[model samples]
Target: MPPRPRPRPRVAVVVFPGSNCEQDVAYALNWLGLDSAYVWHGDHSLDGFGAVVLPGGFSYGDYLRCGAIARFSPIMDAVTRFARAGRPVLGICNGFQILAEAHLLPGALLRNAGLKFICRDVALRVEARCDWLDAPTGSVLHLPINHNEGNFVCDSATLDDLRADDRVIVRYCDEEGRTDGVSAPNGALDNIAGITNAARNVFGLMPHPERAVDPTVGGSDGQLVFQSLLQQFTQEVF
Candidate 1:
């Protein structure tokens, strides 16, 4: 008999009306050899996919709240279910707001400390031993961040719980990858830029790694994140 065909990993990138990075995310995934596609906000089925990504954009125009209206969309119901199964779920920028709004993740993203919409390249340090990156303990990943509401805040007790649970992902840092009192654009707690749900399957962040996939664009630091996740899922399913 012919060798068994390796199963292709799949990703569902949720598309809200204002989502601008869906294609960028898809391109990145496809380039990385994953079977990925865009899932409309109205599509409620996640049958063929093992992973889901909520791409960055101004969902609902950041009205009322960043992801307030998006949490009520039809597809989010399915996204929640996938997350419950311990499937990988990633949310970027506005998608981070939606996840927090849905209570899939903790804390809330507030306006920047400077009270201005900031957009530029910012350095980040990976804090925990994560399946999504599997990066070395002190690895630093530099990428772009663009948002009006990128401040991450939670109560002291909750923050402590997150730390103990190891839910924190990317954190703001300087060229030296220090997470001290250096303020990037917003004053995120402990310089936090990304976090995962209690289960670690659901992740959300403010930076755009998809936007930095090419050396022609100045850096390819974000590609490791996708590779790490791909390796993680392949090890389990294959």
Candidate 2:
């Protein structure tokens, strides 16, 4: 018999009651030739999925705080288990907030320094490489960020640890890739736009890479994020 082809990897995109970006994330995954399925927040299992994504949205209408209530969703328990197993997990925008609230990642997102919602394309400087983001160090990517509370803050000790361990994945920057606070849209500490856990399997970012996958609409720099994950999956790294 001929050698059988390996099954394509499938990703689970978790959807909470107020989640609005699940479809966008699924679309981006499909566009990248990966199968994706919506897993409701109430679901208790994450079996048979190669990776998980918590896309951006106002979960529970952002009451109390962004992602505060969503952290208690039944599916989050599964997500926590999956992440602890060294599986890949991605959290974007509001999703990032949920992860922080769940203590999956360090730090909290505060209201924007301007106290206004920001929705626009922003430049990001790739600071480190991992399973999710394979962009070359110092490279710049343009991704859209839409949120009211995107200012990332943490205690000085945590910030120092993240920097010392090279867990800071991306930082807001100028078009030329300068990461000075001058270009930080939400006043995140050290202009951090994204970060990875110590194991580097879990990633969280404030920007929306799914919104920037098509060049005709904006640019395709966001593809790098998904592509890297897919590549890692292909290598059986999960």
Candidate 3:
């Protein structure tokens, strides 16, 4: 007798009026053999989704700040509840801004120091072991970033806490994975490009990992994130 097959993990990609990356997320998840669907901003419930992703895009036309307006969407309440349940929630680029606005994560993303929209591939150094990231510490991942307001900033106390708890998951670095001031794109404070909540289930990053999942696009380094979530589910729930 063969063992029962594990259930496929279903992911929800939240879609707002102005969201443009939900399809990208869904496609990436599909490539990984996971089931995924878009949840409208008014859905009010996450139900059976095994994971939630806030993909990169100009949500709500980026009005009233990047993610400020989207934070009040009816679905955010459900997202907050889902995150509090220790489920894996990932926020990418503009999604990161929404997570911060909802207070699921700390800090804010401000205008880039250069004051221009940047779109390019960047090297990210995996710095923390978060639930959604299994890359070894110091591994370099190539992910694309496209944003005008990607500079990450937090108050001194919040920064201290994030560092003390090892919640800063990744940092913009060079190809060699050297995280120093010279590698800080958008002039992010302390060169921080990503971080997670103290619980490690809620992760946010400035780079667009979903965009890197297809080999034709660039590299599949970003697939590690989704793969890591699958690994986590197998290890802890199977």
Candidate 4:
């Protein structure tokens, strides 16, 4: 007999007071026929969700720091617990900053090197086939990024460690997938665009994949990330 199909995993999009991308993420999943729901920041449980997303936008008005205050949200406790269980967790843009702040992932997001908010579609190259990306290495993806503090930074040792462990999942690149300084929009260290934890389950990136999920909007490179999650988790009984 053929292998039995497992139930699709439900995704939860965390929404903080200043999060503006929660609905966009939910819509992206719903548009792709996947199950997803919004979880308020005050909620302390993520019991049934198989995956979680910390979407983009200024949380707590970016007070003190971009994600410094939001890291203490009630839902983050549950998120931290979920991450400890080795489930998939994604952080995009401001969300990436939170992941860094929560220590769920390494490195931190700093102000743009140019000191200006950047909003544009840019080219990216898959550096590793982590849980969030199924694309072949060197494959180019075009995704939109919107933020002022999207520049990623880390100590030299940490950068070396991430490089050694192959945790650098993606890098800003030219349309031809060349990893040159000119292609790096925010002057991120090592042109890093995204990364995954040692376990490869927890992922964070500055670009808004959800915004690029629709063909009508221009690019669909972002869909592969979501599809990879659906394909991976839906195949196993969770």
Query: Which candidate gets the maximum lDDT versus the true structure?
Result: 2
Per-residue lDDT for 169 in model 4? Answer: 92
Which TM-score value belongs to model 3? 0.96
The digit string of per-residue lDDT tens for model 3 on 1-238 reads 9988878668899998888889988988888877898999988999888889998889999998999999999999999999999999999999999999999999999999998899999988888899889889998999999999999999999999999999999998888888755647799998899999989999999998899888997789889999987776667663
| Predicted model with the maximum TM-score | 2
Counting clashing residue pairs in each candidate, in order, gives 0, 0, 0, 0
- How does residue 207 of candidate 1 score in lDDT? 93
Clashing pairs in 2: none
lDDT of 1 by residue, 53-128 (tens): 8999987888899999999999998999988988888898998999999999999999998998988999998887
By descending lDDT, how would the candidates be arranged?
Answer: 2, 4, 3, 1
Q: At residue 174, give the lDDT of candidate 2.
A: 89
Alpha-carbon shift of residue 238 in model 1 (angstroms): 6.4
Q: After superposition, how far is residue 34 of candidate 4 from its true place, in Å?
A: 1.0
- TM-scores for all candidates: the values are 0.95, 0.97, 0.96, 0.96
Give the higher-lDDT candidate: 2 or 3: 2
- Candidate 1 RMSD to the real structure: 1.4
lDDT of 1 at 63: 85
Note the Cα lDDT for every prediction shown: 0.86, 0.92, 0.90, 0.91
